[model samples]
Target: MVRLDRITTRGGDAGETSLGEGSRVRKDTARIEAIGAVDEANAALGLLRAQIAAAGADAEADAMLARIQNDLFDLGADLCVPGAEATDARTGRTRLRVSDAQSARLEAEIAAMNAALPPLASFVLPGGSLAAAQAHVARAVVRRAERRAVRLAAEETVNPAVIRYLNRLSDHLFVLARRLNRNGAGEALWVPGGARQG
Candidate 1:
């Protein structure tokens, strides 16, 4: 439904960008920062998906990542329009916002993926198969995005569901990484104080 005829609008050349409501704000504003973080997380997901496809990993995980990417777009849209609930005055149409159901779906996926994985005896080291490593990277980015969203929420009204979704997403990515690591077969567990030279 969105059309982009011109890629270079030269709109942000002045260090200000337009929000969904047509108001311009500095690029460094908290709202913009949150949106940028979400965008970065989405890009990370894309990279993870590429690694998954390259390794011929689980198709189900790739499918989940695809859905999460779309959800990130929805989250970005929700942030662009300020307010916990926003509606267009002329058309009386409510703006696109993140719903609790989306977050619930992520929780369900996380639970399902984690059900078969072995219990963790130690903390994960964030390296395993290429796809699993990529998943860890994506998880880190999502955590950063969640922090940015929380920062924005402190300064202004934000939909609680947006923050909830980001929180659950990071957890989902963590569990997915473990799942991609051959259900703990390829995972590297931390060895406390093992690196110390006696």
Candidate 2:
């Protein structure tokens, strides 16, 4: 329901961006870094989703990607909040926070997916079908985002759910990659030297 055209105020041309609290800071600040990493993960997912669509696969993956995109927006809102709420008096939008239930949902999904995948015996190189390989790339980015959020949490008040979500998301991506690789035409490759260990 938000209008798009009138929102960009051109106030950030000087290397500063506005937070939810109306205060401006350098674009490279910890808050921005966390948000940026999330955005990157979202974009990567989008790319993989598009490839899936092109392949005429089932709609499940696309549907999930759409949901994840929405969650990323929520995460950005949570990150942009100055403290716990917005500063603008006209709009009563509050700061973003992740709930325990959301984190639990991700954990549940990871557990279900990991249950189906075989145990890893050694470090594996990341590549597979185009979509699956892209998923792996997104997984790596999600891990980086998790680390960045952890650092941010150390310095400021970040929602713990964000960290939990990132951790689970990386695991989700790994499973998705393997599943996609199992699809027709996918050629999943493992590290040539990898051997299962008892």
Candidate 3:
């Protein structure tokens, strides 16, 4: 467990922040950007969770979002530190890195959720119940986060599993949105070039 004794240490006032293991880097680094993107996705999940509780439905989806939020935090922890290995001679603490099993679990859940839903004949338009709307927002944010992580990987070594997790996570959110959309009955479908008078 990590404890915060002070919230404002005036540490980043100079536009520099410390990463894991006390390594300082500028706030605008690719790793920091990736972390921020994950944080944004997590915040979107929070909105989805609130909508879930308010509706008093989909308890299972709520639980899943809670777990994914925790996993994103772990991903942030993983990104903060540069080394792939959790423990090294330089930093002798056990760091939390995302596991392949976690990503696989998301894939399994996506498959299960999608099995009962009707096949999509058109693109989804991101509207349904409140919870479903929030899920769509989260899915877009997670996609952005995945792209940021991939960009970071190009410049530096990143855990391959984390990228996989983010990719699968976006899919999970997409299916979850559909599941919350009256079991895919209420999805807003987009018509290709159906608009404007021909």
Please give the clash total of every predicted structure, in order: 0, 0, 0
Each prediction's Cα lDDT score?
A: 0.95, 0.76, 0.92
Worst 10 residues of 2 by lDDT: 81-90
Tens digit per residue, CA lDDT, model 2, 89-114? 45765445766676676667667656
Candidate 2 to truth, TM: 0.83
Question: Runs in model 2 with CA error above 4 Å?
Answer: 84-94, 183-198
TM-score for candidate 1, please give it: 0.97
Which of candidates 2 and 3 is the stronger one according to lDDT? 3
What residue runs in model 3 are displaced by over 4 Å at the alpha carbon? none
Question: lDDT score, residue 155, model 1?
Answer: 97
RMSD to the true structure for each prediction, in A, is 1.1, 4.1, 1.2
**Model 1: which residue pairs collide?**
none
In candidate 2, residue 153 scores what lDDT?
88
- lDDT for model 2: 0.76
| Residue lDDT tens for model 3, 1-198 | 899999999999998899987889999999999999999999999999999999999898898889999999999999988867867666486778899999988988999899989999889999998889989999999999999999999999898898999999999999999999999988889877778648
TM-score of 3: 0.96
Candidate 1, superposed: residue stretches over 4 Å from native? 89-91
